[model samples]
Target: MPYFKPFKMIILGFDGVLGSVLSGALDLFSFTGVSWQRFSNESVEPRFNVQIASLGGGDIRCSNRLIMQAHCDIRDVTECDLLLVPTIGDSIDKVLKQNSELLPHLVRLANTKADIASNCSGAFFLAKAGLLDHKIATTHWAMPISLRQIFHWWTYKKISL
Candidate 1:
C-alpha cells in the first residue's frame, strides 16, 4: 500500500487580514480537503501549522478577529503548493499605480505550476502582476471598468454578490 501526501493550499497573507474570507471560500468548496496554510509575517497562535515568513514588522488583524504577530517576508513563499490572495482595504489606485510591493512576488509565483486563486480586489494584485494577461477572470462588478482599462488584455466577468 502506498500513501499519498496531502495537498497543501497556501494562503498569502499581507497583514493576516483576509485569512477568514479565503479560508471560508475554501471551506465552501470543500476544495480537495485542503490544508490551509498562511504565509504571514506575524506569529499566530498555531491553529494548523502556519509557516511564518519574517516580513520584519507589522501588525496582523484579520477581518475575523484573528490577530498575529508579524514575522515573515514574501521571499519565503517559494515552498507553497498553491497561492490565495485576498482583498485588502487600501488605496487600490496607489497600489495599482505603484505596482504594489507584493506584485513581483505574485507574478513569480503565478509562473509556477501552482494553482492561484484571488478574491475580490485581490484580483487587482494579480492583474498588476501581469498574471491575468489573456486569462478569463471575475471580480466584484463595481470595478469592472477600471479593471478592464488597467488590464486591457484580459476578459473580465463582473460578479455580483
Candidate 2:
C-alpha cells in the first residue's frame, strides 16, 4: 500500500458557534476516507488530520449551550491545508465582537497556502478578517443584511448552487 499524507484541517471553535455546524464539519472531514474504506472492506485510512481550535485551547461554549473541547489553541496552529469557519448560531455582531482576537490569526492563515472556507453565515468571519476583500462572497440566504452592507470593502454576490 502506498503511504498517504493526511490533509490538515482546522475548524475554528468559539463562543456562540453553532454546535451542529461545528460537529457536522468535523464529522464530515474526519470520516471522508475512513467511511468509504470500511464499507469497501478495505484498510481504513483517514484522509484528514482534523482538529478544533479556539483562542486559548479552551472549551467552547456553543450558542445552543453545547460545550465543546478544543483540540489545540488557535495561536499555536501555524499551518493547515484547510481552515473552516462554521455557521454562527447566535447574533453575528456579538460573535464577531467576542471572537475579535481571531481576526489577525485568520489573516495570517489566509496569507498561507491554506484554503479558507466558510459555511452559511460563517462568511462573516472571513469578511471581518478582510480576507474576502476583492473576492466575491455569499452567505446564508436567511441572512437579512448582505455581507457587502456590513463590510463595505467586501465584494459579495448571491450565488445559487
Best by TM-score: 2
Could you estimate the TM-score for every candidate?
Answer: 0.63, 0.92
* Model 2: lDDT to the true structure: 0.91
**lDDT of each candidate versus the true structure:** 0.60, 0.91
Clashes of 2: 0
Cα-based lDDT at residue 158, candidate 2: 56
Error of 1 at 56 (Å): 4.6
Q: What is the lDDT of residue 30 in candidate 1?
A: 43
Query: Candidate 2's residue-wise lDDT over 27-64, tens digit each?
Result: 99999979889999999888999999999999999999
Model 1 Cα lDDT, one tens digit per residue, 33-121: 23332344433233223333323334455555676544456666665566777765455665455435667778777777778878888
Alpha-carbon runs more than 4 Å astray in model 1 = 1-3, 15-58, 61-67, 95-99, 152-161
